[model samples]
Target: MTHATHTPRPTAETWALIRDDYRSGITAPVLAERYGVPERTLRRRAALEGWRRADAPTPSLATPPAWLRPPVSREEALARDPDLAEVDAAEGGDRIGLLFDPDPRHLRLFAFRQASEAAAMDRPVQAVSWMRLAQIVDRCGDRIEADGRPLREVDHLRAAYLRRLGELLPEDMPADDA
Candidate 1:
């Protein structure tokens, strides 16, 4: 007859270490090393416990941190600043993504909506949205300008949606040579 011995589950202290380290944005292997737990075991425990990143709060939650929540409707957005709303809506319909998307076109579209929503809150500027737009422009400005398609009534206005921030800066325009 062979005798069998069972391995004990991780201690609560270990589980707490795993959860806290994971919440602090530590990698599983690094967390495992720091906490003296096996990486696979820590990962399995994390998954079993339903641990998730809290980098951004969800919008559906009530009063979800004013900075974290943008206005939910176009009417609400437009009521704050008619110009941005008009220029922004010209790009497309109202839609707020639940996450940061990398596609330039999507980012550009999201920039307009985010800025408009933020403006509706009566801020001098929507810093993050402008930063995102700048990033999109830096990433794909040449492509957008050369693609030679329009997203608004006037070809130039297609991208001039950004000009709402300024009183018609020349940089917000496409070349007239088109």
Candidate 2:
């Protein structure tokens, strides 16, 4: 006996389902499992619709919870965790860089420790700016530039990540990776 193959036809509802799920920041794998489809199929559908998630903010960022708001200062942040203050103290005016990986339901908050002088110069330290430092580290290693001139800014044990990034990054990294 011979078996006949039939092509699967997609409906408008299918596209809407995919678009809605993606817009809501549902991962392709999660959506595939929910809809009983393969992950590759979901990805293909997303690509076909020109629904690129490269710049879309995760749901957590798009709708942040009250507690996830950015802390105003390093002191306010360290207050919640005394150990952080201790580490800061131990560093003795040197900078510290931290990379956080939060749960899917939450946003990952990156932070950097700056010397009081450095903090005063650039108030309102931003987490995005900190990550930019990481990118610079990855791209240029420990050495960087200052005021359009080359310099070394790595040595996390001694320098603030932002100061390094500011000295290195050509201009400025985007605030929203979203």
Candidate 3:
């Protein structure tokens, strides 16, 4: 005769703590390690029980919470955080031009600036998105100019940029349609 080994189930109190922690934005892996439970088991339980993380947006809500709403105007935003007022004033005409301008150089510069800001904020994914936007702008060949007018030789410039992009990209990256 052979005896089967079984893992003990978590006590009600322990399970409650796990649920609370998971709902409050603690990752399943961290909670599992803290409570001596398997990460897979914790994840499965959380999924089955519909454990919504505190940081996640609730899809079922008819109207989002006030904190999720954007400020109505720049004045309202500045009122909320007075520190932004000086930056806003300094960027006034240039910021408006950045939004309205279709110039590829300006767009590329804007994308690079966004990437830098996102990187500084420790948001790698957002930074990568901005960098990709910059690359897209560069590859479009709208930056090539002759006598202050965009050059008609766009196809050649685009082909060259695409070749450069392929060289810079990792071997495993998906091929772009460009």
- What's the TM-score of each model vs. the native? 0.26, 0.25, 0.36
- Candidate 2 local lDDT, 1-178, one digit each (tens): 9986664555689768877877677888887777666688878878666675645743544755444554357787588787787777755433222222212111112223332334444443444465555455545532332222222344443557667867887765666566
Off by over 4 Å in 3: 1-73, 81-83, 99-102, 118-129, 141-178
For each candidate in the order shown, give its overall lDDT on alpha carbons: 0.64, 0.55, 0.79
TM-score of 3: 0.36
Candidate 2: clashing residue pairs, number = 2
Model 2 Cα displacement at 40 (Å)?
0.5
For model 1, how big is the CA root-mean-square deviation? Answer: 16.6
> Which window of ten consecutive residues has the lowest lDDT sum in model 1?
94-103
> Which residue pairs in candidate 2 have backbone atoms (N, alpha carbon, C) closer than 3 angstroms, thus clashing?
55-178, 144-151
User: What tens-digit string does per-residue lDDT give for candidate 3 at 1-178?
Assistant: 9996777889999999999999999988899889989999998888778898899876666675444454257788699999998878866755677654447787788789889977765677889999999999798745342234433468668978999987899998777789
Give RMSD to native, each candidate: 16.6, 18.6, 17.1
- Can you tell me which runs of candidate 2 are displaced by over 4 Å? 1-10, 54-178
